[model samples]
Target chain A: MHALIQGIILGVLTAGVYALMASGQTLIFGIMKVVNLAQGAMVILGAYLSYQLFTSFGIDPLLAIPITTVAMFILGVAVQLLFLRPLKAEDRSELSLLVTFAVALLLEGIMSVTWKTSVRSINTGYANSSWTVFGYQITLVRLWAFLLSIAALLVLYLLLNRTRFGRAIRATVQNPESARLLGVESSRVSALGFGLGAATAAAAGSVYGLLYPFNSGSHYDLISRLLSIVLLGGLGSIGGAVVGALIVSTSSAVVASAISPSWSEMTFFVILLLVLLIRPQGLFGTTARGAI
Target chain B: MQLHNRLRTTSSLVAGLAAIALVITGCASKGGGGGSTAATSGANGSPLIIGASVSLTGDFSDSGKAVQRGYQLWADTVNAKGGILGRKVQIKIVDDASSPTQVVTNYQNLINKDHVDLTFGPFSTLLTIPASQVAKRYGYAFLAPAGGGPDVFKQNLTNFFFVQPAPTTQSGDVFANWILSLSPADRPKTAAYAELDDPFSAPIAENIRTKFEAAGIQTVYKQVYPSETQDLSPVMAAIAAKHPDVIIGGTQSVDAYAQIKALVQLKYSPKFMFQSNGANSPLEYPNKVGAGNTTGVMSSADWFPGSKASGSDAFTADYTKKFGGTAQQVDDNSAEAYATGQLIEAVAAKTGKLDNATIISSLHSGSWPTVLGDLSWGANGAPTGEFNLVQWQGGKLLPVYPSGVSQAAPVFPKPNWGG
Candidate 1:
């Protein structure tokens, strides 16, 4: 029972970072209707960036988040402008998948050349520090990462709810034609939305590097989990991504602690399958229209 | 009509160029007679061609590169000694990208298409398995440096020869024997396992489990995490909850770091911890985690720098001088690769012929000496060698067991994490 509770706490804290990463995938899907398969690659790129910053300049990975996010945001905007922008509107959704995959491969190639596919982790002074509360160990890095994720998510919420650009983004999601008719530039919104998505991934990646050892190939696993979370939460919904990440991570942790580690990976797909069976539209998805 | 005609000509021209490009790429990928040209034979005194597909770009790149360097070091030294049997040795390495399918394709290209005189094995056991099959089909001798799993020996391939200690099962027994050597008061009462779920690692963990249980240690927590697992917290948490005195498992370098990090964060230090692959090397363990973090960790190794084995110091020095790394960086994988080359040279010198069958037969029958110790292939094509019990002491991996090879006294009840 103690193990179960501890696993749940670990899972919940881990879910915060996963939520941050999945939120980006959800946002990109919401705004552009493109799955943005490169989301994981962007996260890896962010990690590498953080690794470099920490190693080269002795900057803490947590502090490197904003710089990496800005850098990834620009890269995301450029990617959208260069690749997604060229596709015809009729073929955009299907072709974007292939194009994003190409971008992912491109990033992977660059990272392989640069980092040589060796696994690296960021070790800060406080990386291994933890506190015990009520007989439970709370790692300092995970606690900080969770707090940072919540703070970032809150900032994202404010940006969406209390800003003009946020209003334009919501408008575009609801009705692209109506939003365009009202003088909101859909292309600009998409570029910004993609950038925002990438920014979220960057933040998550910084936290991820602190938590896990990573390499260029890590994105493959990250993207799969992100896709599962986004799909389980209901495509393009931030709230759904958060809930989905929490459920997936918590269940996996609980199963790992209670049953066995072998069954932990299966728990994700099993829950995904059950959710899909019961609610075809997803946990928070609408049958009539996609919600963000 | 003009526009349509113009489009037709342009499309035809594009198709023609595409076909030509495809043809060129096809020829380029076959490695194009390079091996064949080199293998023109003992008669013409051309270089002896040896081909291998190494993982240069993927998950196994670190081990792959080390193996490649080992081969190069041997090749350079042999060439400097006026070549192997009066012919310069040429090694052709293609990047397998850590994929078994690619390894098979690379070997096929080397044997069927390139027609190299001999072949060397790839990095890991999983890769070496399929690669040996390809060599067997082509009737070429494959000397494996990095791969030695019980599964490979189980294949019973005549052409496949492994130079490492007999598989995880035997190594597990060696480790168990070492553990059993501990005095009753000093021995661990409880044990736990956290292993990587891969072909090479999983069996080692299983063997360790069987041996640990046989020794009457209370088997507490045993879990196998997926390969490339980034998060080990939950697994560590579960293991920590059990409060086992000894922890043993299979982990790669990166995973070892993760495990150490998790152990520290959880404030759960088992009295003793042993990781199979990565913990044996200082570059993989103590250097990967900060120095203080790995103080009391133990690992099983095929080769240790502390060995009094002949040529060990010379090989280590040459490797360091050539590879531009510390002497400690030259571990079992690199030493085995160098040994593979030395064995080939020895076989060539003794047989006085580069014939594949002659070399294969010689390897099967003879006891050859190399930098990594004596090599004698058993009926199963696995070499009989010792697996040294090594531990991290003062940031260096010192051999602690097998009395003859002991570099330092085994530090038990490893210092508190970060103390």
Candidate 2:
């Protein structure tokens, strides 16, 4: 029972970070129907940026998110403008796959050349610090990262629900031609939406660097997980992505704690397979257009 | 016109694929004369081409690149020394990106298309079998730095030679031997083991278990997780709950850092901890896990920076001069590569020829002096030396096993994590 509870606590803390990473992937798909294959690369780039700032200037990764997010936002806009925007509407979704993959490869090459192939981990003063709650250990860094994820999600919710620009984004996602006729400037929305997606990746990347040992090539592992989460969440639903993350994290954690870690890795892919069989649209996903 | 346009696009696509292939093939020095096999001299006075496919961009990219550095340094050193047999040594390395299929294709290309005089092995046991098969078909020696999985020896390919000190499975036996050497009271009463489901890592855990259990060290927990298993905290928690006195981490790559960090997070500090392949490289290990946290953590290896082996000093000097790191930064993989080069050089000098049949016959008989001590191979191409055990003490990865080579004794009931 104690082990079960501990796994739950761990799963919930880890889910927050996964939700944040998957949210950006879903957001890009919702806005432009162009799956951002390079979302993982953007997140890794953000990690490298945070790693640089922390190593060079002694800035905490949590504090460097603002700078990383802004810089990543500009890079994301440029990617959308330079590579993605050129595709004709009829071929945009199909062709964006190839273009974004190319961008990912390009980013991977650039990162590899800059930071040779080696494993790097960011160790803060509290890297091993933890707190005991009711005979269960909860790491301090994980707790802070979880809280930060919640705050970031709340801000994302506000941006999508409360602002005029948010409404424009939703309108463009729903009916591009209608939104353009209604003076929404769909192209601008698409660019900003892509940038916002990359910004979210940057936020999540900072937390990821704190949590894992990584290198320039680490994005390959992340892309599969992000894609699975997005698919299990029904393509472009943010709330569904969170729930998918919860299922993915908790099922594997509980099984690992209860059974064996060897079997735990299979639990998530199994659950995903079963979930897709039962409800192709996912838990919170709708058959209609996506919303944040 | 439409049919002509479609035909033109298809041709362009084919031409683009060829260009990409050319880029991969020409990764090392380029514009060479016609290729030659090991049995023949370079055509029209071309350099002796040694071709390889390394994992440059994928899962094995880290170790693959280290292997590449070893091969590159050896080639450069050989060329500087008046070119082996009056011909320059030029190495052509292509990126296999860590794919087993890609490695096979690369070996085929190296032998058939490029006709490289000699072929080197790729990164893992998973790759070496397929790669050595290609080398065997073409009758060229496949001297490799890594890929010492027992399965490679099972194939019994005469063309293949593993340059490391010993087979990887025996690494665990070395650690177990050290534990048995300690006084019964000093040794841990309870031990736990964890490993990745890797051809290289899984056997180490099993081998250690056999030795430890026979010595009456009760195993409280063990888990063999897949290589892609995420969220290691739960596994660490499971081990923590068992509260073993010692931990045997059978990890090959950087996952050792992950396992240690997870234990730290769980607040579970064992009496002693050791790993199979991790913590050997000072450049990476201490940085990933804090230098303080690494104290007293034992790791087994095939080589270290402090070795007084033949030509080791020169290898270190050349590595530092070329790579611009300190002498200590000279990695074990690069040493293995240079040693393979030494083995080939010995074969060439002894036989007064570079034929594959002579090379294979020579390797089976005589000992080859290398940076990792004078190495001798059995008929199966497995080396005769044993893996050395090292520990982090006083901010250094000092040799702690084989009394002849050990600089320091291992700390028992190792001080608390980062204490």
Candidate 3:
């Protein structure tokens, strides 16, 4: 019973970062109707940027988040402008997959050349510090990461719910043709939405670097898990992504602690399978367009 | 109309002739001087080619580059010493990218396409196991410097020779015996294991569990984590609940760093903690996990910094000078690679030839002195060498086991996490 509770606590903390990362993925899909395959690569790029700032400039990883996020936002906009904008609207969804994959490979190649594929981590003074409350250990980095993720998500929610730009984004997602007729400028919304998605990834990447050692190739694993979360949550649904992350992480941790470590990886998929069977559109997901 | 037709035919003939000429020249340039039958004998004035496929860019790139450097150092040193058997040594290396299938393909190209006279083993048992089979199929002698899996020995290949110690299974025996050497009262009573789920690491973990249990240590917890696991909190929590005295496992450098971080975060410090591949790495281990945090953690290694073995000091100095790293960076992997080269050179000099059969026979019959130590092959071409237990003390790996080879005494009951 104690182990189960401990696993739950660890899982919830871990799920916060996964939720942040998956939220970016789903957000990109929401606006563009094209899955950004390079989301994981962008996250890793953000991590490398954070790692650089922390190591060379002596900036704290958490403090460097804004810098990385802004930089990644610019890069994401450029990518959408240069790569995604040129694709034929009819074939954009199918071709964007390949284009984004190419983008991922390009990023991976650049990172490998710069960092030499060695696994690196950002270790702050408080990286390994933790608090014990009621016989439960809560790591300082995880707690900070969770709080920061919540804050970032809240900001995202506000941006999507309360702002004129958010309404434009929603209009674009709902009816691209109608939105353009109404002077929404769907292309601009897409670029900004992509940038916002990348910005979220950057924020999550900073927390990830502080938590785990990563290399250029780690994106492969990260992307697979991210895709699973996005799929399990209904495509383009932010709330659904968060819930998917929670369920996936908690179940994996609980299984690892209770049954065995070998079964932990399979547990997520088992839950995904069960969830998909019961609710084809996911728990909070809706079939309606722009329902995010 | 007739004149135009004649002109077209003449142009077509000229273009076809030029294309044929280009093809011939391309093949000629690629063939490397008509494939001289006396290439191995140096009769054609060609260097003796020793080919290898290493993980140049991938997860294992660090170790792969080190092994390649070792081979290069040997080649340069021998060429400076007027060559081996009156011929300069030429090493041909291809990148396998740390894939088993690519390893096989690289060996095939090296042997069947490039026609190298001899082949050295790739880094890691995962690559070496498959790469050695390619050598056997091609009837070439393969000398593996880094592979120590028992599965390779089980194959019973006649031409394959491993320079490292026999199988990682023996590592468990060595570690168990070392633990027993301590006073009974001071020895660990309970143990835990968290091993990487991989071909090479899993065997070592299982063997350690078996041997530790045989030695009367109660194994309170044991689990295998995925190779790419970036977090170990669940495993650490489960182990901590059991209150084990000793925690040992097989982990790569990244996994080790995660494990250490988790241990620190959970504030669950075992009396003794050790990781196989993680601790052996000179740079990544201490660099990732702060040296202070890693103090007193034990790791097994095949070579140490200071040794009185033949050519050990000189090889270490030359490797450091040539590779542009500290002397401490030259660990068993590089040392064994250099020693493997030396062994091959010695065999060539003694036999007065570079033939595969002669080299294999020489290796099977004689014990050769190397920078690593005196190496002798046992049944199934497994080399006999020492696996030393080393502990991190004040930011250096000090040999601490088997009193005869130890440079320092074992530090028992590791200090508190931050102490």
Candidate 4:
């Protein structure tokens, strides 16, 4: 029972970060109908950006998010406009995979050259400070990261539901032809949506740096986990991504704590397989595009 | 319209799967560099081109770059001192991106297409195992820096030599034997082991676990995790629950940093902790795992800038001069590579020959001196060497084992994390 409770606490703490990371990938898929495979690389890039800020100027990583998000947002827009915008509609889905992968490779190369491929971590004074509540330890950095993830997810909800741009993005997702006819500039909405998605990477990335050591090649492991979470929840559904993250993280933690750590690595794929087998569209995922 | 919609949905799933598979592949070389010019004769002849495949862009890129620097530094030193046999040395390096198959292809291209006069080993035992096969097929002498795992020698290739001080399988014994040698009060009562499931990390960790058991230290817990494991929080949580007196981790720099962070978060500190990789490197440890947290953590290593081994001090001074870093920051990987170069130079000079067959035959018999210290290979190319156990003290990795190399006594009941 002690191990079980600790696992739940660790799981819940971890789920928030996974949800924040997956939400961005789902958002891009929802709005642009393009799978941004480079989302993981973007997150790592954001972490490096925050690392530079903290190390160079002594700015806190959490405080550096606004700057990194703005920077990543701009880069995302440039990428959409320069590389992704010109693909013909008939081939957009297939071509974007290669294009985003190319972007990932390019980002990886730039990061490797810039950072020298050595693993780095962002160490704040409070990175390892934890609270022991009910005889179980909870690291302060994880709690702050969890709360930040929740706050970022809330901001994402408001941005998608309450804003005029949110409505435009939703309209474009529902029916591109109809949205364009309804005076929504689909391409502009697509570019902004992609930027918005990348902005989430910046938000989660700062927390990620505090939690884990990372390098340019760290994205290879990340992309797999992100894809698993996104796939389990149903692609293009942000809510589904959250649920998927919660289930996967919790199950993996529980298995590691109670069952076996060796089995925990398989826990993600097992749950993903079971969920995909039962509900191909995923829980909360709609057959059509209205869920955005 | 309905079929097209289904096709789109199906494509999304396929794309996700394919994207995951493709990125995980980590293939795609950064171009096979160097013009396809076949290397020429030696012994005061044209430049002797040595071709090697390194993980310049992918998972092992950091170590690959270090190896590259080591090779480059050796070439610079050798050329400045008048090239071996008075023949100018040229190195042709290509990126394997850390893929095993890609390593094989790189060696093929190096040997068959470029026809370089010599072949050096790639970064890890994983890559070296396959790359060694290609060298064996071509009968080229393969001297590698980091491929010291047990499996590499299992290939029974007479041409290959692992240049490190010891193979990874024997790496843990120095630390484990040291723990056993301590007084009963200082010795750990229980030890827990966790290792990455790679060929390099697992054997070293498992070997330590066996030593602890044989020495009567109770085994508390053991686990082997896939190298690609993303979240280590659960593993750490599980381990802390056990509360073993000593923690032995078989991890490289990234995983090593992650394991320490996880344990710190869990607020569990072992009395003695020995890491097979990360804690030994001053350059990698303090930056990733906070400087204060590194104190008392022990690790095994083949070489350091401080070692009194032949060519050691000169390599450190030259490296600092060339790379603009302090002597303390020159890593074991670069030192290992330079030693490999030293081995090559010694054998070539001794034999007065540059042919692969002659080099292979000479390597099996004679003792060669390198920055790592004296090394000799068995008939199967396994090194007759052992690594020094080092501990992080006062923000430096100081040798603490084997009185011959001891700079300080090993600290038992290691200071807790963040102390």
Ranking by DockQ: 3, 2, 1, 4
**Predicted complexes: DockQ each:** 0.52, 0.53, 0.60, 0.47
Model 2's C-alpha root-mean-square deviation from the true structure amounts to 8.1
Which 10 successive residues of model 2 chain B have the least lDDT summed?
Answer: B1-10
Q: How far in Å is the alpha carbon of B264 misplaced in model 1?
A: 1.2
lDDT of 4 by residue, B1-419 (tens): 00000012233343344344333332432332222213223335678788999989776776788899999899999999888888878888999997776777787778766768888888877678777876775567898887776667877888888887677678778998888888888789988888887656777888888888988999887888776766677777878888899999988667788888888888889999888887777777887788988988998888875998889988998999999889878867888888888987997778777777777888888788888878889977888878889999888889998878888988878888887
Question: Where is model 2 chain A poorest over a 10-residue stretch in terms of lDDT?
Answer: A283-292
lDDT of 1: 0.80
Looking at model 4, the pairs that clash are none
Q: Write the per-residue lDDT of candidate 3 for residues B1-419, one digit (tens) a residue.
A: 00000012233343344345434543554543322232355453567888999989775676788789889998998888878877788999999897766777687667656878789998876677777776775567889887666666876888888875455545544566688778889889999999887756656667777878888999888888887665688888888778899998767567777788888888888988887767766666777877678888887776667765677788888888887777777756778788889988878768776777777778888688777667788758877655677888888888787776788888879987766
Question: Which residues of candidate 4, in runs, are more than 4 Å off?
Answer: A81-99, A167-188, B1-144, B157-160, B341-369
Please, what are the lDDT tens digits per residue for candidate 2 over residues A1-292? 7667888888888888889988989989999999888999888888888988999999999999999999998998999999999999899999999999999989988987887666667788887778998879998888888899888888888888899988998888888788999999999999999999999999999998998877778898898888888889888889988888888888788888868887776788888898889988877667888566
Residues A64-169, candidate 1: write the lDDT tens digits: 9989999999999999999999999888999999999999999999998899776788888888899999989999999999999999999998998899999999
Question: Candidates' lDDT values, in order?
Answer: 0.80, 0.80, 0.80, 0.82
| lDDT per residue (tens digit) for residues B65-90 in model 2 | 77889889989888889777777888
Interface RMSD in Å per candidate, to 1 decimal? 1.4, 1.4, 1.2, 1.5
Top candidate on TM-score is: 3
Docking class of 4: acceptable
- Sort candidate 1 into its docking category: medium
